[model samples]
Target: MSATPQPVVRRGLLDEVTDRILAHIRDQGLRPGDRLPSNRALSERFLVATPTLREALRRLEATGAVEMRHGSGVYVRADLSRLIMINPNRLRLDGAALLDLLEARELIEPHLAEAAARNASDAQLDELAANLDRAGRALDEDAALHTANMNFHRTLGRLAGNRALAQVLDSLIDLHDQEQRHILTLYADRDHDHHVHLAILAAVRGRMPVKARRLMTEHLRDVRDVVIRALEA
Candidate 1:
């Protein structure tokens, strides 16, 4: 049998244009909050139609790299230097897929919690404490509480001192942010969640790796159980 040749993949013009626009932003040293040229100007510069340029801008806007404001020009909203990016158009996962996501987190996050307990500095521990405090205050406000809770998990991942794992966790968290908020409503015990986070933080701050890992594992399992029940009901 003859060896099979790989199919040649061609990049779309839209992707090319998007890359050019991002390059222009970097080449011009544009930072977050810096305004880019007008749409007409960018279209002319990229030699693409107005619609094509708008589409490209919308793609960037969706990724948090830039913000498109009506009546005002496009402004940089994020650092283009990120190593990992989330899927901008990812749809909500079904019950099975959601369970898979939680399973993946359950495996990875507790290990990260252990790493954080071993390696985190006093400053990092204090920051985690502050985040827990924010979560405590936001217990009655769904949106704020969700943000704070997610931040705690994300921050703990980064404090683990493993860049690759941290980036992976970041993408995972960003991908399922909306679903996590929905999970919060399903779980429906804000005080309990806040206290669980506090307990995890205390373990991390105390430099108790075994305790931190155990607490994190218990917390995630509880969340997974909540989701399973919700699906069952």
Candidate 2:
């Protein structure tokens, strides 16, 4: 006998609103960094209650679609163009899961670094240099340094010219963001991390693919070791 068909799941209003908001963004040709309409304006446009609209905006914010800045309004972000993304409602990763995440990064990011060395343009190299400079300046500030470090990895992944792997890396980065920051606090060697980044940037800037790959592998291994110690302690 044939099995019965499963019931179809209906879409929620919030999901519908999220889709509409995305459509609105595309229809208006809004690019990254462009400002969106105000919450009141959006609520009116969507014909939804203020609370419902706010919830929809929150959903979009979680996926990196928009940044809602207090006293500054909402603006677009680059992730809006990404084809794949992490689930915003994912549970916090446990210690084992966190290590697995790092292992995945170690496997993927070194290849990206090598590719960046092979394919990155002069302008992209300059951007990596500027990122390292910012990281140097933020060495004493944990939050700033963390943001700079994450940006360097993200930018390097994109410079590899592999959109599919880049997007996967992006999702991995976002997935472990909280755990990574916590690990940074425990690792507590900002200078060492910064110096390693400088070395990787040098290899990439010099267009030395083998050197870049080796440096990235060493860098991630160091990070993984720190995380392992943190988990044990």
Which of the numbered candidates is closest to the native, going by highest TM-score?
Answer: 1
Q: State candidate 2's TM-score.
A: 0.79
lDDT of 2 by residue, 1-233 (tens): 87889443235878888899999999999999999998899989988877777788887898899999999989999889999988867888999889888999999999999999999999988998999899999888888888899999999999999999999998898988888898887685899888899999999989999999999999999998998998888
* Candidate 1 lDDT, 1-233, residue by residue in tens: 87788433234988998999999999999999999999999989988888888888998888778999899889998646577887667677788878888888899999999999999999988998898889888888889999999999999999999988888888778866787788777666888878899999989999999999999999999988888887777
Local lDDT at 64 for model 2: 90
Superposition error at 25 for model 2 (Å): 2.0
TM-score of each: 0.80, 0.79
Winning model by lDDT: 2
Worst 10 residues of 2 by lDDT: 6-15
RMSD (CA, Å), candidate 2 to true, equals 6.9
The lDDT for every candidate, in the order shown, is 0.87, 0.90
